[model samples]
Target: MTVTAPEMANGIFGGVFNLNYSGDKNRLIWHRHWLVCISCGAYAGVGCFLFAPRGLMYGFVASLFTSCCSIWADYVHIEDPQHLAHLVDRWAAFHFFFVLVCECAYVLHMPIWYLTMTLCLALALFSLSRSSRSRQSWVLLHSAWHVLPMGLLLLPGLIS
Candidate 1:
């Protein structure tokens, strides 16, 4: 079953799009991280197209398309919190698929680095206790999630 916004809070414990931040200072930091993640994601998408092999290119292209949609959803929902849950659910599903594709494509060439990166990603994702409690950590960790997979493109055998 697909989870929605309200249900997402139950799963993530108010992480991701929690707007009840401490103050403008922290919120500003969060916004900066958001921009960083978006920039990294866009860069990764383009890099994947340019660097990935021909057969695997389609997966990255599809991921890039969905990620573009995710970017728009993120910007729009930030302005209006009512749609946040649905957008998160959609993007989260796509992200999982993207991860699977990355795993399949990259693991073929570099197993050790892939394992290490996956471990880091698991740490970042699983450590999200609450966004309210640690907004900086939440944003930073999730940003790592967006950033780490791109490193696969730099792996020796994978880059082409």
Candidate 2:
């Protein structure tokens, strides 16, 4: 039973797996979206250094958790729309809990809160970006929404 390239590529355990697991091929846009989320999380951690050391560390940890969850989802084949939607919601909820913890750390002047905020904002953007078609207008609108968190973060800074 020799499987042709396309057959293997589209199968559940072959190139389809390779493309997603290795991220060498863009067979599914979800793989690319996950990469974007990972990148954004990394950048957020790096950016947190400007605020505080703890923030950077926490951001890195949070990003690691997010990446791990994404990898698990891929491994479990949660790409069907129904499963994917649920996975997204679950991930968002988990992220929110972490955000709360980071907020507490930030309030105590621990610095990790700012990094959490950055990760949240970026994750939100990544979600919106991956939720719909890749139309320019939609992408722009989703990207704009992703940045809305800056206002929330900035408001507190101003008040303080």
Candidate 3:
């Protein structure tokens, strides 16, 4: 059965939530990686109560971006935390491309709020490249990195 947010409402640790995920952040494998993302998409596509003709596009680009970043990291090395260091190396690239897709998807529609949030998310992403020393800071920013895009794509009230 397709999982729903309500079913896992207790949290990620809920029993029903472990369909096929590794649950390891340091190294998120395919099953978990895809489960989390596809679940995210399912939520956005269903729960958002918005017109999401572009949702699949956003999801496709997201997956592609991650794959590309994974390759880039394996081949290259960088020390910078807030720059190409992530794409040249880690998860930051994942967030960047996600925001990139989110940003581009709006070029045609460009609603007032969408444009505003788009800029906000873009700024948040750019700031991610600046690097942070505080682990808490990174945590907050990283969570926002994922939550904001999902919110933009899914939480909007009646997007069309």
- The model with the greatest lDDT is 1
TM-score of 2: 0.35
Superposition error at 103 for model 1 (Å): 6.6
RMSD per model, one decimal: 6.8, 12.4, 15.6
Task: Report the C-alpha lDDT of model 2 over 98-121, residue by residue, as the tens digit.
Answer: 553555465445366665775567
How high is the lDDT of residue 67 in model 2? Answer: 40
RMSD of 3: 15.6
Off by over 4 Å in 1: 1-34, 37-53, 84-99, 102-123, 126-135, 156-160
Candidate achieving higher TM-score, 1 or 2 = 1
Over 23-140, each residue of candidate 3 has an lDDT whose tens digit, in order, gives 2332321121222233223223322233335454554455455545543332232222233534342353436444545554654344657656755674564356224445445445
Give the winner by lDDT: 1 or 3: 1
Sorted by TM-score, highest first, which candidate order results? 1, 3, 2
Off by over 4 Å in 3: 1-59, 62-64, 67-85, 88-113, 125-131, 157-160
lDDT computed for candidate 3: 0.41
Model 1 / residue 74 / CA error / Å = 3.1
